[model samples]
Target: MHAQHDIVIVGGGLVGASLAIALENSGLDVAMVEAAPPGALPPVFDERNLSLAEASCHALQALKIWPLLQTASPIRRIHASRVGDFGRVSLDASEVGREAFGHVVIARDFGEALEKRLGDVASLTRYRPARFIDTQGLADGRREVRVADAEGEHRITTRLLVGADGMKSAVRSSLGIDATRHDYGQTLFVSRVRPQRPPDGTAWERLGPHGPTAFLPRFDRHYGVVHGVPSEEADAVAALDEAAWLARLQDAFGWRAGRFVASGERSRYPAVRVVAERLTAPRAVLLGNAAQSIHPIGAQGFNLGLRDALTLVEEITAHGLDDAAMLESYAARRSEDRARTLAFSDGMARASSNEGLAMRGLRSLGMAALANVPGLRAQVVAGGMGYRGDVPAMCRENAQ
Candidate 1:
C-alpha cells in the first residue's frame, strides 16, 4: 500500500512552501518533498536579494507569513534612468495611493521565515532531504510520485502533483512538457554594500550598455546591489578585489546612490529565461521557476511565481484537484499575466543592453513620457506593484 495525499508538492523552496502554507487547515492531505535537510537552506534561498511586489506582500500576509519577516524593507520610491541619457523617471507610492510599491528582502531571510511558517501548517506532511525519483500515472487518473530519502524510496499517490521544483524541473520533464530557453548572454552579480548615503526607502535602477545596476533598500541600512555585465567579462570582474569592484560599481552607477565605502560577499550567476511550453499536463501542474524562469531585471521572477502559487491555491480550493476543467481554467487565467510579465522582463533585459542609437532614443522618449504623464505613470506603477491580469483574492486590496 502506498502513502496517500490529496496533493503532493515537489520542491520545498519559496513557492512550494508558500503553497503548502496557504493550504493550511484547508481539509486536504498535503505532502511536500524537499531536497534540503531539516534546518538547511536550499540553493534558491542563497544570498540573492528579492524585491517583493505589493501584491506578493499581501498574499504572504494572508498566508500569515509576512509578519514573520522582520527584516523586510519597504520600497517607497523608484528612480529609473540610463547612464549618459537626459531622460529619467521617478515614481512615488504616494502617487498611486499606496504606502509602498513593495518590499526588498534577502532570499535567505525569507526562506527562514517560510520554514518557520511551514511548521504551523497543520495539514502538511514533509519529506525532507528527499529526491524526486519519478512519477507514474495510475489507471484511476491519479499520479504516484516516488521520493527517495535516507530511508530509501517511498511511494505516494496524489490527486494532483505540483512541480514547483524550479528551473530544471524533474516533474515537468516527467510530464513530457517542453520548455523554451533563452540565454541573455549576461551575468548578474549580487552583494550588499554600505554607501556614504545609504538607501532612504528608495530603489534605483541605472541602465547602461551592459545592463541595469540596481540598488535596493535593505532593513539593515545597507543597499542590496545587483550589477550585470557581459558574460565574457564576468570572470575578470569577479577576480577584482573588493575595493576595485566597488570602484567599478561607483563608476558605472554614478554618485546618485553615493560612494560605496564598504562591501559584503558577492555572488554571481548567468541570466537566463526558461518558459514551459504549457502550464499544465494531465493531473500535474507547474509553478514558479518551473513554469517560467525569467530574467532578474525588473525583479519579477519571485513575485510572478508567488502569484502563480496563490492563483493555483484559489483554483484548487474552488474546484478541487479532481476537476480536470479546473486545471485548464487555471492555465487560461494565468496566461495573460505570465505572457505579459515574460515579455516585459525579456524586453527590458534586451533594450537596456542594446547600444543602438535608435533603441537609446526610444528609451529616452519612453522615460520622458512616464515622467511627465500622470495617467501613464500611474498605470506603470500599478503594474510594477503586481496589479496585472485577474488579481487573486489574496492579492486584492480588500483581501482579509
Candidate 2:
C-alpha cells in the first residue's frame, strides 16, 4: 500500500494520539501508526497511575477527552517528606487558588477514554498494529516511511515525520539520531492499595531506605502506590507476599496516608534516563519518550511529552509542515524545557537516593525551606504543574 499525508506520526500512544486530535480540522491530513491493535493497550497505558498536571487536564478538557475520564481523582494537596527526617512540606491547591495541583488518573482508563474519542476526530487515519520499518528522505523534502502491519507492508510519504514511539523509537533509529540512555539502577513497582484510612485527595511522597515511595489518591477509597527499589532488591520486594509487601511499604512510607490493608497485582519497570541529542532531523522530529525519558520522581515525564506534542502542532499550524525553518524553530522552542526537565528529574532521582548524612541533612533543610517559604513553595508548585517557560497556548489559555 502507498499513502501520502501532511504528517505521519510513528507512534499512536498518548502523545501521538493527543497530537492527532489537536490537529483536527486544521486542514492537515494526519496518519498515526501504532504497533498495537486499535483497541489494545500500549505499554504506556498499563496499570501505572498518571499524575496529570493542571495544564494537562486543561489540554484534555480542550481536546474533549476529560469528560470521558470519570474516575480521575483530584489532588487537592501534596505531602512531601523524608522518612526519619524532621522537615516536611504540604502543598495545597487552595494556596494557588486553583481546584488542584493536578489529577491522578489510572493510565488504562485514560487510554480507553482516548481510544473511544479517537474516532470522533473524523480526520485522523490510524494505522493499527503497524510498526515502523525504515525511512528515507525524498528529493522534494518529504520523508518516506516503510511500515509493516498485519495486512503487510505499506509506504507512507509525509511532509513531517513525528517520532513518538517511545524510548527505543524506530523512527529515531531509522533517522540515525543517537540518544543517551542512563539506567538509574532502580525499578519502580506500582499497584493499587486499600489503605485503612482513605486518601482525602492528598498525594503523599516519602524518601527513605526503600527509595521514593508515593501514594496517590484514586477513586473508591483506593490509592495508587509507586515504590522505587534498588535493582538488586526489586525481585525480593516484588516476590514478597501481599502482607509482607504492605508491611514493607508501611515501614518505608509511614502512616501518613494510613496503613495499607490490601493491594492489587504489582507492575514494575526499570527506571532509565534517556535523552536524544537532536530533536529534529531532516523532515522529522521526536516527541515524548522518544526525545527524552526521565525518572518518574516528580511525575513530569508524560507532562513534558504532552507539551512537546502541543508545541509541535502549534509550530506546524503556523508554519507549513514541510518548512525546514519550522522544524528548527520547533527544536529551539523545545530545547530549554527538555533540558530543564531532564536535569530536574535526574537531580531528584540522585538527591532522593543518596543516604549520606550530608545529603540527608541537606534534603531535610530543603524540605523545611520549601515548606516554610511561601515563595519557594509556589515556584515548586508552579514548575511541577507545568507552568514553566515558553508556555504553550494550549497550556496558558484554556484549550477551546
Q: For this target, which candidate reaches the highest TM-score against the unseen true structure?
A: 1
Q: Which lDDT values do the candidates have, in the order given?
A: 0.90, 0.88
Cα misplacement distance, residue 80 of candidate 1 (Å):
0.6
Q: What is the lDDT of residue 62 in candidate 1?
A: 83
After superposing candidate 2, which stretches have Cα over 4 Å from the reference? 398-400
Please give, for residues 1-400, the per-residue lDDT of candidate 1 as tens digits.
2798999999999899999998896799999999999979799898788999999998888888999999999999999999867789998888767788999999999999999998888789888889998897775867988888888888889989999999999999998999999988889999999998768999999988788899999998899999999999999999999999999899999898878999899899889999999999888999999999999888999888889988898898889888879899999889989988999899988898888889888999999999999898877777788988877889975522
Tens-digit lDDT track of model 2 for 1-400: 8898889998988898888888996899899999898658787888889999998888888888899999999999999887767888888998888888889999999899888888798889988888899997675878899999988887999888899999888888899999898888888899999989888999999876546899999987989989988889998998899999999888888877777899999999999888989999888899999999899998998899999999998898888876669989998888888888888898888887787899888988998899899899888888898987776888865622
Model 2 CA lDDT for position 86: 82
The weakest ten consecutive residues by lDDT in model 1 span 391-400
TM-score of 2: 0.97
lDDT of 2 at 275: 90
